[model samples]
Target chain A: AQSVTQPDIHITVSEGASLELRCNYSYGATPYLFWYVQSPGQGLQLLLKYFSGDTLVQGIKGFEAEFKRSQSSFNLRKPSVHWSDAAEYFCAVGAVAGYALNFGKGTSLLVTP
Target chain B: NAGVTQTPKFRVLKTGQSMTLLCAQDMNHEYMYWYRQDPGMGLRLIHYSVGEGTTAKGEVPDGYNVSRLKKQNFLLGLESAAPSQTSVYFCATAEQGRNQPQHFGDGTRLSIL
Candidate 1:
């Protein structure tokens, strides 16, 4: 079975500050990883995804994540966050040939002014 | 394009009541999924379909049933609503490849008393 773990439940960062959200997964083989963001009362939006690529992947809204296979992690990072970045973020793991994904408990990001 | 759209953006139901949630996608994707989001539980996959008429149970499928009668639509049904089922439901669609990121709908907020 595949599982994802997001260590941070809530994080507060000031505008223009760097941010990093930790995510770890347990999967037998090379996993398809994704990062998604959701605003209050809205559905999730894809931030980024990693299948078989370079270690680092860039995403929308000035976000990026690095896939560290040895650590079983795919942490999302941003050089600077804006006020509009306040939202919940999730990490998910999928099989190489599967229809569903297993998601971790999300991290709530609060962008402070 | 609408990408993905979920019907009845919000609904409230009493315990034992039944209702169906509709998910439609305009992306012409072959894969669709249903998930429920609760506080501290991110999004748990309830059911998924790889193609029309091919439904499969996901991580948490206990109280949900799903159907994919058309390639562009997936429906999730709650036969008997319960308080535990009060949460936001999301529908997502993706292209045929596992590497493709799933696009999500705005979500349906369903509350059961």
Candidate 2:
């Protein structure tokens, strides 16, 4: 079984401020990780993914995440967030056994200007 | 190109009713997935297909049925809708490998009374 945990349910950040969302995953095998973003009433969009690569991976919309195997974490970060960056973000874990993504409860980001 | 398209963007159904949600992908993907999103629940996989004619249960598949008769289409059916099933449903497709990112549709908001 694979699972992802996002400790922050909701977070508010001032515009232009740095932001970091924590994600922890548990899987028995080597895991493939993903970060997805979703706007209200819309489906999820891929923010980034990590399979077998460098620990630090950059994604679109000025987002990045670092995979820390020792900590079992993949936390998403942004140097600066814009008003439009407010959305629901999810972290997922997958492996070759089933190839199914198990997503976390998500973190709601609110950017305050 | 429409990355992924789900039919009936919104629907309301009474308890015990049945309906099928259609998902089609233009990207010639080898994998397709169905997921439900609820507040504080993030996204839970309902069912998934690795290829045409193959369907498997995911994290949550008790109330859902899925079929993949064609490579480009996956259908999720709710045989007996319940209030617990009222949530937004999303369909996604991925390339042939485990590391490939999954592209998603706009989602279908299904409300069951």
Candidate 3:
């Protein structure tokens, strides 16, 4: 079975500050990983995904995540987060058998002025 | 394009009541999924379909049923609603591949009172 873990429950950052959200997964083999963002009253949007490519993957809205096999981590990062970046972020892993995704408990981000 | 849409953006159900949530996608995707989102728990897959007329159970499939009678639509049913089933439900679709991004719909906020 595949599982994902997000260490942070909530994160607060000021406008123009950098942001990073941690994500770790437990899977037997190299698995598909993804980052998704959910805003208030809206559906989730894909931030980025990692399959078998470069270790650093870029995503929408100036977000990026690195896949580190040694640490079993795929942490999302942003150089400078805007106020609009405040939202809930989720990390997910997928198995090859049925394309079912195992998601982590999301990290709620709050951007302050 | 209305990438993915879910009907009944909000609903309140009493215990033991039965209802179905409809999800439609305009992207001609071959894979669809149903997931429940709780307060602290991210998104748990309830059911999924690889294609039309093919339904499969996910991480948490008990007390829930899904149908994909059409390639563009997927429906999730709750035979007897329970308080524990009260949560936001999201529908997602993706291309049939290893690492395709899954598009989501604005969730249905279902409250089982």
Q: Quote the TM-score that chain A achieves in each candidate.
A: 0.96, 0.96, 0.97
The sequence of per-residue lDDT tens digits that candidate 2 reaches over residues A5-86 is: 9999999999999999999999876789999999887888889999886999999999999999899999999999999999
Give the runs in model 1 whose Cα sits over 4 Å from its true position: none
lDDT of 1 by residue, B22-99 (tens): 999999999999989888988988888999999988878998999999999999999999899999999999888877
Write model 1 residue lDDT over A42-69, tens digit each, in one string. Answer: 8888899998869899999999999999
- In terms of lDDT, model 2 sits at 0.92
lDDT scores of the candidates, listed in order: 0.91, 0.92, 0.93
| Predicted candidate 2 versus true structure: per-residue lDDT over B67-96, tens digit per residue | 999999999999999999999999999887
Each model's number of backbone clashes?
A: 0, 0, 0
- On the 0 to 100 scale, the lDDT of residue B48 in model 3 is 92
- lDDT at B64, model 3: 96
Worst 10 residues of 1 chain A by lDDT: A94-103
C-alpha lDDT of residue B59 in model 3? 82
Candidate number with greatest lDDT: 3
Q: Which one wins on DockQ?
A: 3
* Tens-digit per-residue lDDT, B1-113, candidate 3: 99999999999999999999999999999999999999999999999999999999888999999899999999999999999999999999999986888899999999999
